[model samples]
Target chain A: MTVAVADVPAVPPDLLTVAHLSMRFGGLLAVDDLSFVARAGQITALIGPNGAGKTTVFNCITGFYRPTAGHIALERGDRSFDLDQLSGHRIARDAGVARTFQNIRLFPRMTVLENLLVAQHAKLMRASAFSLAGLLGLKGFREAEARAMSLAEDWLTRLGLVHVADRECGTLAYGIQRKIEIARAMCTEPCLLCLDEPAAGLNPRETAELSRLITSIRGEFGIGVLLIEHDMGLVMGISDRIVVLDHGACIAEGKPAEIRNNPAVIRAYLGEEDPRAGPGSTDAPGAGDGA
Target chain B: MALARAAPTVSSGVLRAAFGEALVAAGIAFMLALPLAGLRLPINPMDSVIFRPWWVVVAVATVFLGRLGLALWRARVAPSRRNGVPLLDRALAYILPWRRGIFVAFVLLVAILPLMPFADRRVIDLGAVVLIYVMLGWGLNIVVGLAGLLDLGYVAFYAVGAYSYTLLIIHLDLNFWAALPLAGAFAALFGVLLGFPVLRLRGDYLAIVTLGFGEMIRIILINWSSLTGGSEGITSIPTPTLFGLTFTAVPAPGETAFHQFFGIPFAGVHRIIFLYYLILALALLTHVFSMRIRRLPVGRAWEALREDEIAARALGLNPVMVKLSAFGLGAMFAGFAGAFFATRQGFINPSSFTFIESAIILAIVVLGGMGSQMGVILAALLLVLLPEVARDFAEFRMLLFGGAMVAVMVWRPRGLLAHREPTATLGDLSRGREPAP
Candidate 1:
């Protein structure tokens, strides 16, 4: 149902281009005319204060919500996905856009391996011929199943979850569950991966492990990563680029060094007036329209 | 050391609590059973009433001793067993090692049961009834256990299958073998039709809608007198033959019945044994087919959907296709069972496919443990055969059944076989391989 809505061909510059993206819940403009680009093979951090529209932007891009108005285009290797036009599941299935929840959402009763195998459901189902061929243990179905298992095992090992592969997911520690969620999303082999607050409840050690995992995921996998993180330390440590948002509109977008020094970005986090608060601010052009 | 120190006070407190509980239990037992146990019912033929006061003391003493023994056992074994597996669980694990062997042996026995010295006609017939329910349970297991869809109207599919066979074989003059698949197809069609509207509903709402659908089909079958024969139902339906040869008392013109064709004597046991084996084969087929499906991708998808629908959707699974496949496949099995039921009885009616049948099938699935094929068989035998054995108690059979069900639930809330394994296991990763179990 979601795939059918992707009728228009759309290709913007870069892996993902959010052009004039706007979202509204009733009167609240959760994301208002926000625009940014995330290049392929880079970790891009979406940072803002507590109520910033970071998660909302992720939700709209993933097609969980019908944006009030916007153009969110994702360009895969040979194809481009008009994310705004695609619905929720098609965005993940067809557009190669995968996302993790703010809270971990692993299939708890299923084993760690099963959780990852389930991520490759579409491909296996296609090869299985509605499971009749699989039931008979046909060659094609067996090969497909073997491929799915290896992919799952690969992701599990990368996330350091292979030891607990046979254990049900719910029994695992919270930090491990988070990694499994990321690994499960990775099993989909998406070009663009969106992670929501992956380090929310981790300790300093686990947070460091998460930062290393995220860095390796980008480096080894060569995929664009859009991360929503509250930990400034992990964000500044791993991000190649940072986009700052306040309320619903973008205040600044640039390299981590430039973003870290920007007066408006500081003011958004500190929530105070400074000598550089006005139009004199580098990226903050009075919040309305810098355009 | 701290645990050891705390153990003394904890043990003393436990003992005091047990003493207090036993005293209260004894008091309650005495008051409750005083009149019931101590007094004779209908009095005697000579007197208005006869009081046996020592009966009350016996009741009180039994409760007192039983409670005290239970308390002491809980204090002693429960504490030590806390850090260790319980004996019941250990026994289950002991059985687990031989589970596959046990299952094979059980199936072998079932196969040769009709030939067994002790196997009477009534016993074989009862076994057939159990097998029918076993088939039904396996079918519903796909929808409810694997797909995680709460479908309470699975019996509707059974009803559809039976009616389809009745209409096709008798009315349309189709062969029983040909009508079998046709019956299953009709049931699958109904499954898909019912599955479409309730695709978006979850949990209790899905259950209620399916329940309504079941009732709706039964009501229609009742009111459509011309088509279904109403409450009177269709009769004299042709039974399934062994390759067009009937197992009959009187041979049809130009037709050589089963016994004559085989050159065996025309004994009723021949028909009964044939029917038993027919159902046994069907049940075994359903079991083997479902277990294989469980290892396949679509089966894994059903499990994923069951665990969490949002997660399944996130995996890019087409929920509609997965859910419908479960419904269609499950209903097909139900259809097969229903056709067999019709053939076995040579009569059909709406009353035979009631909500009670659906409930019993579901109870087998749940009590057997959701998704476990072997659990379904065990549950079917327990639910079906236990009541028959308890028939000596007559009206109390149901009460005994209810008590046993309650006891099993209290013992294992997650069902009998709660252990789960991953759907797929790798031989080895490309690198950094862990040894396979």
Candidate 2:
């Protein structure tokens, strides 16, 4: 089911284009002159060591942070949204961008089903006529509620969380909570899904399963997947393209095989004195060279 | 280590620890009661303090014995009980299973209480008062419990409702029924007004701002003498009528008295009973509305915002609108209760709606268990009736109330009924599968 990198069109349509993005927190420039492109139906992995401004890029793309200087554009057919100009919520609501946090952010007291339904709030809220129809249990609202419920059930079953669908999310196992977060984000039906460190605290088997699930989501939904992950095995295995960041700048960007051999990427990761001295050394240029 | 030791030695050690702890408790109690209980101030400051040593002795002994019992229970009975189950938890387990039945029974009892022979005029009036608080508690439950917004100025909306009705009747010549909804609408308006400024605040900050807003409204009522009559609140406020029938001993000319319309002799108790039922119906409306809205999308959004605001915003939910809606709806119910208050008492002043009133209502929501409907009723009854029942111990009534609150907090830190059931279930869907156990 995986498409070879060589099979990709020379100019694939860009779902998200973040150019010259710079985010400064007071004196610290968290992200500096970062630029990247995530094509539709492709898994783009943003990988770097801790504090490499990988999450900062994701934040700017998802409208969580206003970049000091940059353009973050999300193209959906005929329409394009400047994510940097929109508020945090509107970026998700109007622009169709959904995201998951590094730390799990499920509504702990709410049931898993409720958490998923909440992700579909914008649609259900409109159907309920701001709760007037829901209050009266009108046919329109009931049908909408049923549709939302089925969507939640579909995600729960797919994620193997059906057994704990009615349980409070906080009471579930950590691995299950991670899966629920992904399910919740998917329920929003975003054009681009940004997952910040999706496999941070998972076992090898769970990480492998996550890789497969993420690939299937990309293939089945035809949505762009922008992932910030530390698990190198999973990242290199599933990513169609990989973007490497170091100290808030793009160090290298290319196919997974190229990134694996790029001397700058190895030097950024291993802190090697010379590019040729690293384990996976290659006669490649230094940082800030985007392929 | 202690449990493995000899039985006699363990018993002796337990006794010694209990006695030491009780002695310390008695010493602390003596120190506290010295100025308050042992010595009392006479009316005149010139007079010497009147010493009441017996009061001090009684206080110390009560503390001593209570502490001794608690210490012994922990050291001796508690360890063995832990192997099985604690008495309180076991009792709760038994009661929790039949909570729905208990709730229905409680409702039935209250519904038929006024008709009971034992329910005198005083009892009915007290019942009405308790129901008013119950309605207020439930109204605040929406904001404080489900939305997780700490609103200390809920009384502002209540005051708004009361004043709205009273002024509408005075200026516009409106009847009670006509003014009730308007009063609620005015309170909701004020709720939204207050909500706008404090939308960014949460927890303690929100509490402080709301507390200030409540006081601001009360102060306005006190200062704005022209519209609100200042400190001298509007008096001779008209009581509510059943249709065109007034509940008066002698009907005004061209007015039909309630008893005359009913073809029965006039009795003051009839008016009291009517007021009781009126407040009961209003409280039930508040209860049913809160319950229904709990399952709605807006309700879920409130709860979702409460759990995690940032995460909620990220998921495309507007925190501003969600918070405002909660504030508006919560205040609407408070307004309804306020209108009822003004009509029932026939007089309302700034003194009636104070910070303490807000505290009492918040206490009921908390002590009852936040967001739990039945818990609010139980807590309102306990909080309102406990003081009235302890009238004989006028000097110690507040003391008893505070003690009961402390005991409940220590035993049930999450409130009396903290268990929450999800608003929707998977089994409700037509999946043709049994719900997970």
Candidate 3:
């Protein structure tokens, strides 16, 4: 359900600017001088067939792997951070960049509440010497813990995981696990959330729920979301902008409708048609085939 | 209708699990009885098999109970057209009661141990020694067990505490009691300094650095003759005194200390008992302190860091501080144990604080179970006491010890005992509360 708030803040454009980013793995070029922009308060989809170097770019931006060449800057109001040189943790803490794994990376043995609390570890350290001094009803610590608990509970309720809050993260159902991962990432209060295939293993109903959740997060939190999804229906319905990639190079960039009809995207998806084949020759032999 | 169906299903599952356990018990009983099962008893002590007790009542009880347990389990597991049981429930039926029984057995043994006929002087002395290892095992547990950080140079701190008290008492002319706290302080200082360099290393690298550190201290003691007294060591170190009375054969001032004070015979055993009780109290104090720390915020952070360093950092926990605290606190315990050891022995040498000592302490913690206080104590006692009792089997003692350790680990890869979950909460020990972000 879309919230009817007329005075909603407009999403900022160019929240993340990638300038000539390239990553080489020895002799192989994973991403070749790729450049893109993720707008604020919007769902920007990065889609490609397998090996199009989408994840490589995500890794570069998240500080897991340093780029061989390029600069990634995050704009917050008038300030921007050159994220290329920062460490992975500093990227999360200082640059307000958080992400979820294609395969869930929740701490399996810890409780759901703990997973969310751990994301706020930095903020807690700043407030107290871990004195837990106010952990119970202590003014500062209690307020912080209460806030974290409320946020965690709010997200868990939205995702239909309220009953499983005390269970181990590892024991949750597969679909619920993905929602927890996303909630955990959000708990960090990131300026930009990058999800690597958030709907990869979800059922149709779960996928629909995910689509609604993403749009609402953007609208409610006013944070930029960069997602890589293979489900065409979910992508077309939710994404404000889409970037198509083929062989580690951008093929098309536009609104979903524009991208759907782009000639280059069609070619990448459907190889050249063999005139001799038959009526279905227009589908292009060996092109756009979903592996 | 649902209740009727669920009842049969649940009870049957319980019966099945009970049967499996009974079979295992029966097998164990048979093995124990094999020597006397109409087969010739191995009269020769050097028989291929190790010493086997011939307690008749225990043997009968093992057999009868084992059979009954197996029968009940089988009846419980017998299939019927009733309610469907969840997979987890079936597994739980088998595991929960088994562990509960182990807990009961351990408690009973500890409760009745003092009343046993073996409360003779030798047994009491052995108990005292076992208590010492319990302290050492607990100290090492904090470093390697709870923190999941391998510390191969742990004995270095022990050596520092011992040498500190010994040298100060002998050369500086300080009383034993006066030098104890100073010795602990000296060890803690070295622990902090070690934390600085090894901060960059973790896992295997951390273990290697700690190993090198222990050896470095040993080398310093061996090579630096003037300061440490080198190979000769500092001997004739004074034993602990009870107020003004010494444990020496010559007795204390004015009259025989015990005769004058308690109007009792002047027996050396009284002193031994006093020292034993003292160390036992100190060891118990260490145990309680460790448990308190484990429930604190610092303890939770240590577990978090052990589980996933990257995730812990993302949560705002500074790894440097977390790690330093673990090293410092763990070393502090070792320092206390070291001081107590120095006063007990009345002498100190580099030979006494070798790498082997470190290895034994670590082996006790790991072989018991990581992060378990009670498990570590049990392990320390079993490992130390068993070997001492098997002294007459000197030729095969080392082989049996190594073999037993390997077998136990293989059977329970996690450890002899493992906790189902962490015990501590953040607010208590980790830190006081702050507002969540």
Give DockQ per model, in order. Answer: 0.46, 0.61, 0.16
Residue A261, model 1: Cα distance from true site in angstroms:
1.7
Cα deviation at A227, candidate 3, in Å, is 2.0
Q: What tens digits encode model 2's per-residue C-alpha lDDT throughout A62-128?
A: 7778899989999987899999999988998889899999999999999999999999999999999
Error of 1 at A179 (Å): 2.3
Encode model 1's per-residue lDDT on A61-160: one tens digit a residue.
8887878987999989889889999867788889888889997888898888888888887788788887778888899988887888878877776666
Docking outcome class, model 2 = medium
Window of ten residues with lowest summed lDDT in model 2 chain B: B1-10
Which portions of model 3 miss their true places by more than 4 Å? A1-14, A75-80, A126-154, A269-291, B1-125, B164-206, B238-297, B313-321, B423-437
lDDT for model 3 comes to 0.75
Name the best candidate (by DockQ). Answer: 2
Candidate 1: lDDT of A86?
85
How displaced is residue B403 in candidate 1, in Å? 1.1
Candidate 1 regions exceeding 4 Å error are: A1-12, A273-291, B1-65, B428-437
**lDDT tens string, model 1, B286-399?**
888888888787888899888887777777877888899899999999999989999899899999989998899999999988887888888999999999899998745886
Best by TM-score: 2
TM value for model 2: 0.95
lDDT (0 to 1) per candidate: 0.85, 0.89, 0.75
- In model 1 chain B, which range of ten residues has the least summed lDDT? B428-437
Q: How accurate is candidate 1 locally (lDDT)?
A: 0.85
